[model samples]
Target: MSEQELIYLLALQKVPNIGDISAKKLLRTLGSAEAIFKSTKKELKLIEGFGDLKINSIHDSSYMEEAEQELLFIEKENIKVRYFEDRNYPDYLKHCIDAPILLFQNGNIDLAHKKIISIVGTRKVTTHGVAFCEQLIEELAPLNPVIVSGFAYGVDICAHKAAMTHGLQTIGCLAHGLDQIYPKAHAKYESEVMDHGGFMTDFWSGSHFDRKNFLKRNRIIAGLSEATIVIESAEKGGSLVTADIANSYNREVFAVPGRNTDQLSKGCNNLIKTQQARLLTSVADLVYVLNWDIQDQKKQQTQLFVELSTEEQFVFDTLKKLGKSEVDVLALQCKLPTFKLNPILLALELKGVVRPLPGKQFEVI
Candidate 1:
């Protein structure tokens, strides 16, 4: 879009009570933001949901002045702006009714044919929650999924770090504008995140830094990805809000189950119990529920088995036959020494043919 068109869009965005949905309605009715501004009050009032007050705001010059100033800031900072109707705008977000009319982004973000998932949870994440978040990303590294998260403490940061550690692109959806990062302490990670993936938000440079902004930001987190995963959340938190939004968008929502008594697990458990989210245990669950190329996975599994040594194959076969069995039982059934079987099992685990369970039991993946 031209600078003039963008300025008009921004001016339209500045009109109070004219949100994304209303703006889109006007745009569809008039065909363009510039045309909307040129429309007479009678024409504007003719559009559904556009009251006399909202129609009058279009004639105010202050909004255009603000848009011009914001445009200057945008140009000065060299920030990338994506119009809602532009091809470069996020495909999934574009389908959302409340998605911003314009999205401001920075860094190298490429979403083409990428499997995207949003990871969210409580700010006060537990040790186990952190470990699970990291392990989940590590296991999914092979899939090359783009991780999306709020750039907050705990699960969000952990997901971003794990994605970066696995050399995957990650997106940080911010509550505030791109001009500053919230939680000043996270500033240390800003450069690294930008280098790996980058940050995104719909807020303008001078938008307020209010608590309500984070709640509004949750929609972007939920809308950008194919699925949203809740690692851990308390009975009430922003992560749950994101999960709810994702569900509302008809996107898959996955929540990791926790012990019933754990405070942080309550929200996830409630989500699962209410059928708002699928119960997530591992990457396999996500793969199965999302129906993500099971045939390809089977082919990969066949290739992996072909590369396994005789002993490794034997252990794999034994685990497959037993479904899930203790190491002692597996070693006995395979007729291999416990010591000898351990290495074989580890190799199979690394090959993704098998997964280890608690109490030394194992199961075929």
Candidate 2:
């Protein structure tokens, strides 16, 4: 793409309410972005949804300067720009008609991936919500799903940290851009995520974090991922918007149900009850839907079974038969202390012979 075309797309992004769909429509009608700039108001209005006011806004020279400056600042930040036409732009996202025209990104990104699941929930999450967020992703760690989230306070932060802790590649899709991180408290997590082949955002360098920008940002999170999971949400919630957007993109949506009467459970329960989302009780539920079974990844379970202590080896041998039995159940069956089971579980998980699941269960590969 040429410099003018690049800046023209940036200027189009700057044009309030002139989103991806409309911008592409105008670009298609005019043959090129430069033609849109050179055309008369009479010529531009021939396109749909271009009011006289929007036409004049596009003609303003200041829009060009703003776009140019935005590009320069992006260069300063060393943020790579992905145009909608770029083959490197997320292939999954490209299918969405409203996908952003340009993205200002930081960190390693391979937009084409087999599994992408976004974890979004209320920032004001309860204690149980926190535990589920951490444990569920920990269980999912073995599958190596490409975790995606908003990087918000409650569930998003937990999901990112958990993925990072397990050394997984996670993406933080921001309401703002690579020039700065929103909330600012997440700078540590963002820095660490970058180190682990993660990715940042869809906004440009100069884009400010306005409230409505989040509504638009949620679409990228939903569109990029194959599935979206709601950990906890109020009757009125942020994750609902992500769920709605994911459904709009024809992606799977799941929500973890909480205690029946908890305020945070309302949105999740309503979602499952109304058939808007599937009830996600375990990592298996997601892995099953995404078809990320380790059955193909199973080269030889024997290769993963070396160097285990007598007790650890015993637990491993037993789990292979039971198919995701709980630690207590394993202890009872093996006639051993489940208390001594933690280190053995970790060792087996590290070696890839056994996979952990929610509620302290383990499954053999």
Candidate 3:
């Protein structure tokens, strides 16, 4: 359970073709990875799946050599490493069939028993899909649910950005090792997420973003969260893999409804019609299904109106004192220029710090 021991275990785990299930089986019978490491070829042969030929591979020296640089890097970066046996390792992820033997995490990791809702879908969602995800995520974000996603483009990016806009914590499950980002475009968002109490993944430094690894990564995405939502995906999109895995794990799967004839909505409709996923049409449905504390949060929200720019404070106070009103009324009340006030209203609305009603009207909703 010590860091050094876990590192050795993870190195063994990182061995090509050697998986967590087999490693755990060996550990259960033999005790620690240290013990497993000490075991001679003949003794390893006693385990069911650890054949003599495989046992011959047990004492292989490449593990230490392959992991030397990663160990050094981890030590240098001061990254927190947790193993399967560590209490800090997420319990939900532990329940999966092949959870990582060790995770190399680099950020604020909140394992609190909050509602975790994963949003995933096509990396090439349409404009409609983007808007759908944005509004839904915007509504759900204020409740402080733990958001999870693959950190890919389109819907994944949309969910993370939307959650972040509302100051929500969002974890990204990367397909490759934690050492590198696959899609270099997401670097800045990744940094923001890490700063805002989100977490990275399990693989070692040198793991590649291979096709099979992405498939394997889907299990963690499904297992770590309370529910998975498919925002928009074509029939053959990869996001469905996460939904399927979530279902197999007896977890909830939800999908946003899209136009029937739209090809991108095909996967979502398939999930809903086949009972693979629940249809989510509004934020209320998600909050209720997830049993999030939207009402409680609203009641607790004090409307401190702190950290406001001079203009924000002016607009905010005007609305606070007055009952329901229009944006123009507030603009007149604040006496601020239209350019500045409009964007501020939008920002506040997105944060749920303020809201807008129909008919050029604005009020807290």
Best by lDDT: 1
| Candidate 2 residue lDDT tens string, 1-365 | 88778888788877865778988888778777788788998887777788978887888888789889988887777778887778888777889989987876788766564567889999998888888878777766656677899888988888888888887788888888677777788887777878765665667665776988898889988988888999989998778998998998899999988777898899999999999999987765676677665654334334723676687688888998797798889988888765446545755765667877898788986
Candidate 2, pairs of clashing residues: none
CA-only RMSD, every prediction: 5.5, 4.8, 7.3
lDDT of each: 0.88, 0.80, 0.77
lDDT of 3 by residue, 231-286 (tens): 88899877999999999988889998778898899999999999999988766566
TM-scores for all candidates?
Answer: 0.85, 0.84, 0.80
Model 2 poorest 10 in a row by lDDT: 296-305
Which residue ranges in model 2 land beyond 4 Å of their true spot?
300-316, 319-365
Ranking the candidates on lDDT from highest down gives: 1, 2, 3
Worst 10 residues of 1 by lDDT: 296-305
Candidate 1 per-residue lDDT over residues 1-365, each given as its tens digit: 88999999989988887888999988988899999999998888777777878888888989999999999989998889999999999999989999999899999999887789999999999999999899788777767789999999999999999999999999999998888988899999999999999999988886888989999999999999999999989999999999999999999999999999999999999999999999987776787688775344434555622586777777787788889999899988988877556656654665667777898789988
Q: Kindly report the root-mean-square deviation of model 3 from the true structure over all alpha carbons.
A: 7.3
Give the Å shift of residue 95 in candidate 1.
Answer: 1.4
